[model samples]
Target chain A: MIILIDKKGFVLSLDAAVAVVLVTIILMGSAFFFLKTNETFIVNMQMLRVGSDITAVLQADGTLDTLDPLQIKSGIEEILPISYNMRMLINSTASSSIIIVETESAQTNKKFIVAGKRFFYAVQGGNAYPSAVTYEVWPK
Target chain B: MKKAVFFTLSLTMFAFIVLSLSFIFAGNAATDDARFMELASINRIYDLDTSLQNSFSKIFSLDSEMTYTASTTEAIFQQKIPFNFTRLNNSFNNLRNFAIYNDKNVQVGLLPNNVSLRVSQAGIVNWQNISKNITEFMRTNSTPKSYSFIIDFFEINITSCSSSSASGNFSFSVAATGGNGTSCNQTLSINPLQDASVEISLGTKSLTVLFSNYSASVNARDNKVALTSRINYADTGVKPKIFLESKINITVPGLIAKKYGDLRIA
Candidate 1:
C-alpha cells in the first residue's frame, strides 16, 4: 500500500502555457481582421478609381454632337470595359449621366447634375462620405 | 487530453473569427467603392448641364440686343426713303438659330445658308448673288414713292460639339406702304410703313419680341419720328420692356405733299 502525498497542495505554474495559447488566439484573430479590412479597402479603392475615370471620360467627350454612338462607346470602352449593367442617360440640353450598379448590389444610391459651371451633388448614399473633389465643364 | 481538446477548440474558433472578419471587411470595401463610383458619375452630369444653360443664356441676351438694333435701323430707313425698305438684317454673331416669315406667311430670305447677311449688303447695294434679283429691282426703280419691301433675318445653329451648324429659321417681316390716296377729293401722297414684329421661340422656356415704328413727311419739311421697343421673357412668365425714341428734321424741298408711316410686331 502506498501512502498518497498531498501533491494537490503544489500549485502548477501554467503561466507560460496560458500565455502561449492566449497569444496564438489573439494573433489569429488580429490577422483575420487585418486581412479582411485590407481586402475591403483595396476593392473600394479600385471601384472609386474606375467610377472617377468614367466620369472624366464622359466630360472630356464634351457634348454628344457626334452622331456616332459607337465612337462614344468605343472611347469609353478604351478606358473601362463597360458591363451590360452600365447605362448612360443624355438630356435634351446636351448633358449626360452614367448609372452603374443598382441599390440592391451595394445598398446605396446616388445622383448628380451639372449646374452652370460646377458639378452639383443631388444625392448620396447612407454609407458614403462627401467627396472633396469638385469637377467642372469649361465653356465651349 | 482535456488541455489538448480545449486548445483545439480555441484554434477552430480563432480561425472562424478571422474568416468572418475578412468577409465583412471585403464586403464593406466593395460597398464603399460602388458608392464612390455613383457619386462621381452624378457630378459629371451636373457639370455638363450647368455649362450648357449658361452658354444658352448669354447667347440669348446678345441676340435680343442685336435684334433691337436691326429693327431701329430699318425703321429709320423707311422714314427717310420714299420706297418701302424692308430691313432683312436678322443675322447676328451670337444667334445659333433664327427664322423669318412675312404677314402672308411666306419665307423670304434665310441667312447663313440661303444668304450670308454678314456680307449680303454693301451699304444700300446687294452684294450676294441671291440678292441680285432684289438689287436689279432697286436700280430700275426711278420713283420710290409707291413701293413695298419685305426683309427677313435669322441666326445660325450651333452644335453640341461647339461647332456651328445650320438650324431652324427665325424671321421678322417689315411691310412699308407708299402710294397716292385720294382723301376729300385731294390727292395726298401717303407712305404707310409697318415694322416687322420679331418673335423668337427658342424653346418652351423663353420668348423674345422686338418691334419698331417710324413716320416721315414726303414734303421733307416735317420732323421724322421713330420708336423702338424690345421685350424679353424669363422663368417668372413676366416680360421685360425696353423702349427708345428718336427725332430727326428733314429739309428736302418738294411741292408734292407725301406722308410715310409704318408699324410692326411678331
Candidate 2:
C-alpha cells in the first residue's frame, strides 16, 4: 500500500488554522477589556446607591427632624464602604439654610469619585419640612 | 486528515472559553440588580416609619384643642382627633410593595415571617375607631428568613374638674415614652371665691373657660353641662383626648459581614 499527500490542500489547511487562532486572540482581548471597564461603572453605581439609601433611612427614622446635620452624616459614614470617602449636605427650605452634615477624605484612595442626591420630607415643630441631602463618594 | 482534526479541536476550545466568560459576566450583572432592589426596599421602609412618627405628632398636637369644650362643665366632652388616614394607608402600601420586591427571590426570606402593630394605651376605652387593626399581619416564629415591623402606640389621658369655687386646683399631664423623651402637663388654681369666669391655657392655642358662682356650694352642682359657651382652640392634646406615642421596631435577617456583594449569597 502507498499514500500520497496534496501540497495545495496542505497549504490551504495551514492558512485556515492561522485565521482561527487570530480570531480567538481578538475575542479574548476584547472580552477582558470589557470586563475591566465595567468595574468602574459598577463601583460608581454602588456608591450612589449607598448615598441614596443612607439618606432615606435617616429621614424615615425622624433623625432629620432634630435639625442637627451631624446625626445623618455619621450614619452614612457607618453604612458606606470602608474604602470610600463621603460628604453629606442638607438643604432646608423652611429655614433657607444649607448645612454641611459631615465630610471625610479617603486620602490616597480618592480617584474615580461619584455623588448621589435625594429629597425627602422631615417633620419639625408639628409640620412637614422638605429637605435635600447630597452624598459624594469616592473609593479609598 | 490530521490537520483537519487539530483545527476542529482548537475551535471547540475557543468556543468553550467564550461561553464560560459570558456566563460569569451575566452572573455579576444579576448580583448587582438584586443589590439595587434590596437598597430600594430598605429606603421605602425608612420613609414609611418616618411617616408614622409624623402622623402621631400631628394627632397629639390636635389633642390640645379638646380642652376648649371643658369650660362648659359638660358630663362628656367628646372631640374626634383628626389624623391623615390617607397618608397612613399610602405609606403602608409602599412598605408592603417594597418588601415583596426586595425579597421576591427564593434566596431572600422574611426572617421572622410576620409583621405586627401593637397599641399600648393608658386607658381601656374601646379604641377600635382610632386604631388600625394589626392582628391581620401578626404571625409566629418561622424559619425561611423573614422580616417584621412592630409599631407601638401609647396613649395617656388625664381629666379633672371641681364644683367648688373655694380656691380649687386642677392638674393634668401626659408624657411620651421614647424618641426625644418629652412630657407635657397643665396646672390651674382658682383663688378665693368670686363670681368670675376662669380662663386656663393648657397648650398652644388651647383654652378652657370655667364659670363659677361664688355663693354656690360644691354640693349644688348639677349633672347637666351647659354648652352655652364655646371656646375654639388649636387642636393639640390638652384636656381629654388620645395622646399617642409611636415607635417602629424592625427585625430581619442580616449578616455580620459588611460587603454589598455578599447580598447575592444572602
lDDT of 1 by residue, B1-266 (tens): 46655665666566566556656655664566455445444433333333323322233232322232222122112112111122222322211121111011111221221121210111111112222121111211111222222222122111111111122222222221112321111111232234222222222311212222221111111112121221111122222122111111111122121112111111
Cα lDDT of model 2 by residue, A1-140, tens digit: 12225554455456656666665666566666557656755766677666666666676676765667567667666676787667776665556667776556334642765554444445667655545555666666
Model 2 steric clash total: 19
Candidate 2 DockQ score? 0.05
lDDT of each: 0.28, 0.39
lDDT of 1 at B103: 13
Q: For candidate 1, what's the RMSD? A: 24.8
Q: What is the DockQ of candidate 1?
A: 0.05
| Cα lDDT of model 2 by residue, B62-141, tens digit | 42232212211111122223323444444334433333333332121221212212111111111212232211111122
Per-residue error for B36 in candidate 1, Å, reads: 7.7
- Identify the runs in model 2 with alpha carbons over 4 angstroms from their true place: A1-10, A37-42, A105-117, A123-128, B1-266
